[model samples]
Target: MNETLKNNTAAAEVDTRETVLEVKDLVVQYVLKEATVEAVNDISFSLKEGEAIGLVGETGAGKTTTALAILNLVPDPPGVIQQGSISVCGNDMLNLDVKELQKIRGKDIAMIFQDPMTSLNPVLVVGEQIAESVRLHEDVTASQAFDRAIEMLELVGIPGARAHDYPHQFSGGMKQRVVIAIALACNPKILIADEPTTALDVTIQAQVLSMMNDLKEKFNTALVMITHDLGVVAKMCDKVAVMYAGRIIESGTLEDVYNTTLHPYTEGLFNSLPRINNKGSELKPIPGMMPDPTRLPKGCAFAERCKYATERCFEERPASRYVNETHTVACLRYDEPDFHIEGVED
Candidate 1:
């Protein structure tokens, strides 16, 4: 039994030397006419090769904005990446020229957006959509691209023969598979799935997630899964980042964050989830709505909602402090000298 435990512990550790994606102190803001809204505050994280990271937060917490910034897809009119750097495969994504970026996008990194219906072009055949993605990234012939598209369809569990059908002809789950096919058409090293299972039924959701897990392993693709579902995070991710407003308030291995939750916002999220074991227990939802991005609070964005918030929390921003080598929390409570709170050992 001791040997088994030791083996499990060894397997859980990730080698950081081979990082696939790196985002450093990224800041993205929307330049609205009335006021500038900071959509993504100074956030930083890294993705290692063939690992999955879950980004969990309530709506308007800037999860989607961060993903958009990674791909340099944030619209310029209202949205802008003000500061920070994003490096994928050692390529500076933010500094890449348009032509260079265009070459790198699908070839090195691809995204499966939130809504499959909108993401897939209704006018075009599903096969053509995937083929176009491949053709754009690689210098392949039309026939070769189409052949690759059919192979991708097969890879995602859809029949290669059905590739000729248009997006409207397939079911919602199938359309999502086609979208995945398009994203993976070039065999990208990184895949960003933003709420990939949101629109599916429970069974189909499970199926899609299973398929994604299988495909990710088969291709050795690093993944960023953006979702509010802690259940999904527990099932799919090696590490997790809990976001509030625009900043990542807590980050660590799945066991570190879930088993020994540090941030009040993260704890509140777990409390809100209905547990099969805790029958009849009242769900404790986090109090207060997300702050308006245009007029954010002076200190911590979650201070008003955090039950454990103190005077320091409302006065100044807390620096990220490491509870250990792998776990970190941006909370004033951790910085309280000689403080020992329940469920936290410092």
Candidate 2:
């Protein structure tokens, strides 16, 4: 087993709070006639009640696939969860039947998809869409569900009366608000928001993020926020996981991952970002593209692009190791007794 599974499990063991979500050694892939795509590989993490974690990575890093797998929503023909287990509130998610899974989807765990435009139905009024989810999970009449839907709309900062409007009638931000209402209508224990603010303007993005953070606190919901934006992770997440080529290369508290980056891929992400304090400095973007999922390297996927990579890094897959109580990094450099990233203190 990789150290990721062992180290993450050990981290979970130390936490005293109730674990609302746990994913153990998850491996997801897409099998096509052309070639098999390795998406998520042996990733493990757990979330306590009301805590939030950020799945930060570039596109095609399998953030969305991981989220879909948790809800058992991965399309069957092309996609498959070849191994691993997903647990939500002590219920085994992968083994649950469709009917049982349906019960948990909206109530126990809800997802806010990437795009708000395609997520909603234009034909149906926004109120009914939110009401549908409420009706599905709760033992309530249509009128009660509609009432709850209006309450949800109001909670999301939309006028309760606007619930009668169709999705087309609302602006991009408002439509996103409506989508948030639908996801939160059932008061889910866990919420997986997959780039909820991706489509909005900067002003609206802050508004939406603030609103989601407020609602999460109000509902005491554990959140798995998937995004490519490190700024978003810094603002919303208690813990952060940096994924590269379908694996979590580094994970820890926000301060640990952001301030004390251990993995080369994660350091590259930070280096690529524009810094206000360093206005004249050119951005040091990570060189080369992400590895092809179908033709992933047998060793470290980032070895080819990594400036610090040694011959050993290209020949052997690195195992995750603890840098501190909460911080874990998958880098062979950590295995050496005296090795350290040039400027990072011991």
Candidate 3:
């Protein structure tokens, strides 16, 4: 992790621009017959135009739920937005009507789901799917939308002539590229990519990520990338927000969080990453699994797994403490003068 951080030191500088996505006190919950699961608990973060923020955490840390909440796509009946404010390009997402929200989805914010094989319709031609998204969002004829779809396919490195093919006709990597094209066809202001590279091989993952980076720059799109891959975060994001349970435990510029890790969980995350130089060393996985969302602890959710956890960590939840202008961490250790951990900053 240290070597990876050192090598990617130049990846943290995000361009300053007007805020494109602002989420404040966002809380999402799921109600089942058995229990009420708190999926996202009072989390807030903002993204600037043309910026990308990596939401990194273990599975069930609410990364995908956060993305769904932002796009107002949280499944109802079981899932509900208990409270939150999601603003995209100055438009209030939670308060919008169904008609208005529908209008905003493809044009203002688009999503590329994790599995392209399931995301794309198996029966329909890939070009038609992209064209449908374009025609739905923009006032264009079917012919024009098809042309735009072809252009989008070309942009993602898939030949425009291949647009007539079905999902089964393309390879895994190309299918993912088609997903990217559909997300970009509307030229959305924001793109929520949920583990876009999870299904691809290493080489294909690199290609998809490279295309995403190029397309983001071309469209000036703000992105909320939800993934557990730190290497992906280092390469694609300017800032990072480390999530635990349903909350953002630490957030700042990539350098601040990666180089000077503050939270014990954040430190543990970096420690857990396999170092390229240390070939013989065993990887340190975070102890225990994530707490059950339905039965979360009254104190810190990570207290059970954290080695540095004290009595206070089990007794009370910590408030967000600002260690610097750009960095903030939620931990009781920072409040205690006697608490100290090597390789961690206050």
Candidate 4:
């Protein structure tokens, strides 16, 4: 960690706000007839009320799996939560019955999935879709729910008259806003947005992100933003947790991770981004690919690609340790005295 950056730890200190969501030692795996896949290895994090955190990494880094686990929606046949606890607003999600879990899904916690086109029911009017969610959770009549749905559409910047429009009638950005409106229809305490802007154009993406941020503030909702885009993370998140393979390699406040990145994987991610000031420079993408989930490395999953990895990194797994009070990283080099990763010069 950079010595100068260590002094800027005020934002990374222990949050005293009420914890809205908590995951402890979560282990999720997919059981197959041929081979078992370790999707999410013992990863844990928490979100306080109205706080936002970005879960960032390459695809198949178990970001979606973690979100599904939080909602207790991981499919039973193939996917399973092998161990750990997920608590939302003090309710134990893992132990709840089907009926009990349904009560919390749309009411307490909501999710905006990856693709908006497939998320909505094409046959149903957009208003009804939102109203259906409202009716399920709130003790409101059909007419009242429909009225609430219209308000939700208007809230997302869509016209109330467009409530009768089907999903196909709206553009890509409009559909996403509808999806967001539905998720926030009942005022969920937590919102998990999994690459909400992936399918939209850059202009629409910016608008949607701004809208979501404003809505989050208005509702005081804790948010978990899962994406591969560091740019999105910087704009919307207070804290960041970088994932690799199936575990969190590094995590801290935006300032801590961005200014004083600890893990080599995190460094690689930053290096891969195109710099505005140095437009002519070539991007430095991480070498090698993610390890096979079915047969993950015995030690560090990132050792093969990390420039700083030693023989010890390939043999012994490193435990997550806090460099400062709130900044945590899982690299063996942190155990060495006065060690720091030297930045690569262009």
Candidate 5:
């Protein structure tokens, strides 16, 4: 993180309202040679306590970047926290020093990544991994931590109570369970799950999601689930944030995004799905490729592919204007309520 990026963390007093995690005006840049890629543009949103908000986008749309930025885990060389305020559990994550940040990160907030194998240490037994997390954050003895590890593994639906099992002893699903168990061992108030169900079979996915829901309810943890799967988002989230080219295109309640998709980018996503009842129906993929983040097009990045885009969209980016009390979409068509998305179909 550059000094410029580090200094951008000054934040106003938190919104005493229903927000527990507030990611405000965040921008993340990855400098490669002479180029700087805006992995996450000026994006902002809030995650209330016990609320699950899904972040959905195609690969490279900055879903992971946003998550990493919040965690302050952006690696060097290619990444820098450009600007933003990531306030979680009444603390400013970006502004805090590394020592202070570490204390809050796993202790108050946790993350579960996509690849469990890489996440786990090959040398250490799975039990010690979770035990280390508990010991790191809490004043617990090794025996107590080991016992807690077994309890958490059981909570996450791992079959065996053997905390001494090595990472290689577990199945892919089991590895994920262990990863999640380690994440929750510290009893964090916030949990960030990045592509939690990817690389798992459908049955395992459901079970993991069920376990997560149970855990969230039990712990009252605010969850930030990052994924490209609309199905997962629909199934797991109360609110949804749809991103394109590093910026949020639309955001609202699950019903708002599903029932009344205001952005054309979101519409394209919904169109690309096969209806549940229409099994024989053809899958409609979104036409055209995703925009390159490093050299994004002028105005709205999705304008070229958006069916509702107009000539004006080619010139200026649309502000995230309100559609209702809670729903907001970054599209100019909403300026005229009578304008139908079907009008601009290519």
Candidate 6:
């Protein structure tokens, strides 16, 4: 195994006590009619049992594509996992056939997408969705599955345990929880939550986040939370991966990423954090839109907006450089011994 993957598994083992998922050199590409776009460019990471890692990036930064590629859910024709390997428990998932992958997709690996209303089936009852997930993985009768569905609802902090409740009967927060309950109903080893708090109100968002955190500990499931919210990662993830234009710019422990941020894109995320001092001030959003996947820049993706970007940053693509024991960034300038963490004012 490469050193990065080894170290990643080691880092994952720190909190989880066991490695569950390992993704290496994941490259998802989209073959449009006119062009090919690299949605996930050479990304690698791993998750251990009971560990959570947040993948942070803007809307078009290829966060969702990376998540989907992990589950081999990339839509065909337009989208394809062009390269790289993904392994779960030492088994290569990228090489698995459709039928073989299907057996693991929900049974061992589950995902909760951004919009629950769209992701959930409108024709099916909420309980039915959760029960179907259970019955698909386990040998159980319809009645037994329904009872498990109620248990999942209760597990997710939902009030009503009625198995007849439909998606229309629930609010946005409730729908999100139902989606989560369905995701967890199968008792998957790895759960990928993609923008889980997108449409939730502040109070609901916090409650749902708290419930997910509680569920993480209770189920001992490794979590890959893909979100643009820095605060969420700091609160929920033990480690974080900062992505930009299809590649991971930085990866570190929550303390290493938040307390001593190394990459420019990661620092931009700090601008989004809620602050008591900045209550009256305007929210400082990250400047510059993401680069087009079809025409990605030759070097660093954040070069256009990064204040510290040098000619080398744009002229040459930097390799992943390690700073200390637990942090890595794809910036060459930081290879110097005198390199310091940027934007983190003491």
Candidate 1 local distance difference test against the native: 0.90
lDDT string, candidate 6, 59-83, tens digits: 7878999888888788987898878
Instruction: For candidate 3, write residues 1-346 as lDDT tens digits.
Output: 6974563454445433778899999999999999999999999998988999999998999999999998888899899999989998899999988899999998889999999889999999999999999999888999999999999999999899999999999999999999999989888989999999999999999999999999999889999999999899999999999999999999999998888888889888877877787777677778889999999999999999988898989999987887886799999888877775566322
For model 2, residues 211-318, the per-residue Cα lDDT tens digits are 999999999999999999989999999999999888999999999997888898888887787877778867777789999999999889999998889999999999
In candidate 4, what are the lDDT values of residues 217-320, reduced to their tens digit?
99999999999999999999999999998899999999889989889999898888888888898899999999999999998999999899999999999899
C-alpha RMSD for every candidate: 5.2, 3.0, 6.0, 4.2, 5.5, 2.5
Judge candidate 2 at residue 58 and give its lDDT.
92
**Model 2: how far is 75 from its true place, Å?**
0.5
Q: Per lDDT, what order, best first?
A: 4, 2, 3, 1, 5, 6
TM-score of each: 0.93, 0.95, 0.93, 0.95, 0.92, 0.92
Clashing pairs in 4: none
Clashing pairs in 1: none
- Candidate 2 clash figure, as a count: 0
RMSD of 5: 5.5
Error of 3 at 262 (Å): 0.8
Worst 10 residues of 6 by lDDT: 337-346
Compose the digit string of candidate 1's lDDT tens values, residues 1-346. 6985575477568443367899999999999889999999999998988999999998999999999999998999889899999999899999889999998899899999989888988999899999999899889999999999999999999999998999999999999999999999999999999999999999999999999999999999999999999989998999999998899999999999988888888877887778777687777787879999999999888899877888888989887888887899999887667764354222
The stretch of ten residues in a row with the least summed lDDT in candidate 3 is 7-16
TM match of model 4 to true structure:
0.95
Name the 10 consecutive residues with the lowest summed lDDT in model 2: 337-346
For each candidate, the alpha-carbon lDDT, in order, equals 0.90, 0.92, 0.90, 0.93, 0.86, 0.84
